[model samples]
Target: MHLKIRHRTEYRYETPVRYSIQELRLTPPQVEGQCVDQWKVSTPIKASTSHDVFGNLCSVFAQESAYTSMMIEAEGEVHTQDAYEFIDAPKAVSPYHLLQQTNLTEPSAEMLEFFAASLPQKNTIEEVLKLAKAVQEAILYFPGQTNFATTAAQSFIMKSGVCQDHAHIMLGLCRASGIPARYVSGYFFAEESPNLASHAWIDFCLDIDKGIWISVDITHACLIDARHIRLAIGRDYYSAAPVKGVRSGGGGEALSASISIAKII
Candidate 1:
């Protein structure tokens, strides 16, 4: 399948920002079954591109001058295979590195006990999807109830969150079970609504020595299909966030992001 995608983020500040720098993981990588045909990023200033430790294509840009607003946009075309799982090549970071829990993915003691028996003994697709099903059932998909900083434990206690929360919960459980799982941040082409375009999922390593992984969309309770476009992946959301930045003087900022995915015939 071929897809055209555009993502735009805008920030308006009540006060001028004297200096700001942004790190973007918006560019998708050409993995086993995914190919990045063409891609471009638009920013207020020239951006430098490089790869991060996780092997994600990243771009960095800085604005030194005072500014009241800023915009960053990434647009691209990609072709993907219909397969749900693929063997990713080895990276600078070992799959074992993902087993380390981050603040966002650390599970509560209650969560660990709740999923203790259900955690997959073998990292098989069938067994993992069962875990995904249990996660989706346990956590209702309710937006606005949680934010990016929400932890897996918090969301599990609340019993509701969006796709990010679902992915984090899955990550926490999988790692606790001694499975290597990474957070996948990407675009999911939904025929139903544009609001669902921005999505999150998980890929648990089946054979770490061979870099084999099964990608699962916990929110949907299924393996990733062609509709899923790969982006940056990391231990948790903070590492894989499409846009992350710091500013010296921006105050009371209003931020908006838009994502669009269209399937090409």
Candidate 2:
């Protein structure tokens, strides 16, 4: 399938920023069964492409001068297929590296208990599917129930959150159970139900030595296929966030984002 994606983000500050630097992971990867026909980022400050520790195609940008607001726009056309099973993909790092938890993806006592009782006696692909389904049934997809900084424990306790929270909860439980998993940030195109085109998911590396990473979406309660276009992968949301920036001076920032994804064919 061919898809067109557009994402825009704006940051408004009450006080002008003295200087700002941003690390952006907005570029999608060139993986098996996926091809980037075109891609671009529109910002006042120019950026040069680079890769991060995880091999994500990224960029770094700094404001030329002081400003009260910042805006970033990304547009791209990509073609994807369902053939990417990561069977022969290059191993970037040992999947065990993801066992180390971040604040957002850390498993809480409640989550650990849930996994202990809910996970099947044997860990198999079917067992993983059951776990994913359990997570989906446990958490209601409510947008206002959580925020960007919400932790997996917090979301798991509430039993409600967006895709990001769902993904984190899955990551936390999977890693805690010795199942290697990582966070994925991307765009999902669903023609019938268009909402929150920007999405989050998790990829479980059941066998790192075999170079197999299976994409799973607990939010939608299904395995990801061609409709999902990955932008970046990291230990957690903070690491995979589309934009991370620091300002020497700025106060009371307000943020707004808009995204749209359409199937070209």
Best by TM-score: 1
Ten-residue region with minimum lDDT total, candidate 2: 82-91
TM-score of 1: 0.96
lDDT by residue (tens digit), candidate 2, 1-265: 9999999999999988999889898998888667999999988778978888788888888885879988999999999987435542364767879888889988878788877766645545677778889999998999887998999999989999999998999888888777888898988888775775889998887676786877888887788888888899999999999988888887899999988888885
TM-score for each predicted model, relative to the true structure: 0.96, 0.94
TM-score of 2: 0.94
Error of 2 at 183 (Å): 0.5
What Cα-based lDDT does every candidate model obtain?
Answer: 0.91, 0.84
RMSD of each: 1.2, 1.7
Off by over 4 Å in 2: 87-91, 120-123
Clashing pairs in 2: none
| lDDT tens readout by residue for model 1, 230-261 | 89889999999999999999789999999988
- Candidate of highest lDDT: 1
